[model samples]
Target: MKILDRYILKSFITTFATVFIILFFIFILQGVWLFIAELAGKDLGVWLVIKFLLFYSPKMIPLVLPLSILLASIMTFGSFAENYEFAAMKSSGISLGRAMRGLTIFIISLSIVAFIFANNVIPKAEYKFVNLRKNIIQRQPAMAIAAGQFNAIGDDFNIKVNKKDGEKGEQLTGVTIHKRKKGEEYATIIKAERGLLTSSESSNLLQLELFDGYYYEELKTKNVRDEKKMPFAKSTFSKQIMNIDLSMLNKNNMDEEQISQTNSMLNISELNYTLDSLQNSYTKETQSIHDNIVKRTTNTLSREISTSERDLSNLEKERDTLKKDKNNLLSLLTTSKKQRILDIATNNTTSNITIIKNSKAAQNERMKNINNHWLAFFEKFVIAYACILMFFIGAPLGAIIRKGGIGLPIVFAVIIFIIFHFINTFGKKLAQENGIPPFLGSWMSSFVLTPLAILLTYRATNDIGMINMDSIIHQITKPFQKLFKLKSNEE
Candidate 1:
């Protein structure tokens, strides 16, 4: 029995490793396909690209692990059943349950490891991956700017070019540059027939050398009377050089605290803390909204009372005097005054409505972020459970199908994984939009697969094959066979 357990465990481990590698490779290729635009023609170093991919691999583990487990389990169990190893074991009084006992323990352990990875390892990896991409983008800012597009540099310059050339993108043609200072209406525009871009790794300055260009400057006077005659200056030059600062752009330097605030970069406890803070903020914002509405409504309806001391008779006289004053004010109001009052009322109403709408929009955005944090919080556990559930499903399915190798098992595993992926993606989207409860949305895929896993396991344990299509086909063709025999006899 110990030997049997070891054999099965060894087989599963080998298959799991193979399947995981293949799946991991495929997912890496897919990621490459998705981000080739960012990577291509950049001349990034081999080590740099490798480091980027390495940082990115941890994020793919949650997506890849369950599929690999499903494929490996199916292939392993299917090969055993197809080769009649299960039958041989049963004949020797070893039940199917005994064969699965060792593998089940291994799978549960894998699930725990996966959970730990999601909690501890993946968040850090995600943080690194994001920062790596940011560094790459910052290192090659010229690659990000396309030809014939206005690319703003820092706060003071906008650069554009009609054509760019060379592998390193060192050559440029038909360059247009605009320079301006803060709070200035006029700008200095430079148009060149050709240009060259160069930068150094140690310095934060980007230098552009231009040839056969003209510089045009628009000067404005501070006086309003002189603005009608704005002065302009133009000069042609054979060659010129300009230095632009690149220090302000987000570089490789990032505060870990600020980046960790993102949901993807936070663990369960961090997410819960963030969620509590967001909920408090949300509550305070809502209370502020209520207070504003009540305050505005009260202010709109209330009128100031005159400070005075009076008895009952004095109060009656005062009321009569106020009524007379109101009548006199109404009489004094002109048509323009009435129109102005109506306009003021309209404007105030419009302002209040706009404020309410903006408040609701802000609240909705905050709620979406809250939902995202909750989803991330639940996702770690869900994916861990997914690994265990997928194994149960694949192992039982493989036994029932009795098909070995990658052929039928691959098809079944892919189909199940697609369903799982779709359900999970759709549920997350629905949860983000508040269409479903965050808990339900996060666990929807697991909820769906659990029952299917149970049913397949039950059928496999009872030695029942699911819906024999061969028997159904034979039954359908039997009537045709009898009709053909009757026709032949008559002939």
Candidate 2:
């Protein structure tokens, strides 16, 4: 390799390494801040905390790599242009494209590496990170209950404690438990002055022994009139013992539902498999809902529904028949029979409406989950392309701007990155809400920035200013120039 290419590559690598490390650390700190609640006051040791952060750090790569490359590109090239090194190279006939050859190859390789890391490393890291959180709760059940907050235990209980002491944080003070029963809200409440937790590893139940406590339970009566009195039972106890099940939290067994449920923990192949099952399930559920509606509204359409085999077009056609013979269809029926039919129709319609309202929410949620999987699938490529995109933009923009050393470069990088990030976020949100296709949502940022990169590269290659202000000024004054010329001619 020529000295110039080596020099350029060396400069960019040094700058990229420096910028990436700093930005990565900053983002990791941001992650730490975001989840500080889970880490702080849990009594997790320094080693465990460090391990947690280490597992989490890889997830920041998609954000950090592109921005770091952009900043580094701009800084290195801007420094080169500012110092007249580009001029020296241009004098020797080393075109900008030629100068970028080595770095371009390096960038292509880097983007591939980034994609691999995203597809492979990121998923594994996410799995570990999530499992670590659960493992902490598993090994130390007390860690699951944070002080000063109502920690929910499964679907049945919400327990809160003002303070927790002892080596394993088993001793509790000012404890409150809200027990949930079907068809009731805050149905049972247990409060204690002090409590102690004891759990057996072999058993899933964690025993809570409370002292100086009171128990209050809302009583329900089968008689509707008596229920209005709002009867409740209250009692005081010097010592109380309750067992809480921690099976799901500590089972160390994989739930098939949970395994298929998480998008972040799956690789591209796994995502494809999961998405297929999800789409099929969504379709089946949707058709099932339509069948239920059909069953409710029209007994005659049962044959049509069964024959159509998931197709509802024939049932829709029957709607027009009812509309066309609206009066004739009821004319042959007896008056009492007609009234009974009308009453049944009204009840069926109300039931169908309720079913539709409930099913709509479920369908939307299912569709959103599918969209998320697609988003995750496309995001890997988008981030990989972003590395190349940012390089094109930053390297050319740096040369055009002709300023160096993180002064103007930092400002430009930040503004451009913010725009990219905002557009990306907007697209993802829109896709999540089913406003747009997930493919488009994932690539929205790249699409918006690609043209800018092309324009910048074109300008830098031809040695044109970032903006042709002189041409704009001349055009703005052209009419006046012509007017003055006419006046001079008349004079």
What number of clashing residue pairs does each candidate have, in the order they appear? 0, 0
Q: lDDT of each prediction vs. the true structure?
A: 0.85, 0.87
User: For model 1, what is the alpha-carbon lDDT of residue 229?
Assistant: 67
lDDT accuracy of residue 190 in candidate 2: 94
lDDT of 2 by residue, 1-491 (tens): 98888999999999999999999989999999999988988888898898799889999999999999999989999989889999999999988888889999999999999999999999988888887776776656777789999987756888999999999789999999999966775478999999998987688898999999999898878887786677778899999999887787666732211322379878899999999999999999999999978875778333222422324675566667778887654544457666766677787788788889999999999999999999999998997899999999999988877778978789889999999999999999999999999999999999999999999998898898876544765899999999999999999
TM-score of every candidate relative to the true structure:
0.81, 0.83
Tell me the TM-score of model 2: 0.83
* lDDT score of residue 176 within candidate 2: 98
Local accuracy of candidate 1 as per-residue lDDT tens digits, 1-491: 59999999999999999999988999999988988766776567798788778888899999899999999999999999989998998899887777889999999999999999999999888888887777665666676556767876668888888888987777889999999989988899999999989887677888889999999898677887676665778899999999888875544443322233489999988888999999999999999998997788567533222223235675666676668676544333456655766676677688889999999999999999999999999999987899999999999898888878989789989999999999999999999998998999999999999999999998988788896634675799999999999999999
The best candidate by lDDT is: 2
Off by over 4 Å in 1: 139-169, 173-191, 214-236, 250-260, 304-348, 469-491
Clashing pairs in 1: none
* Predicted candidate 2, C-alpha RMSD: 9.3
lDDT of 2 at 277: 97
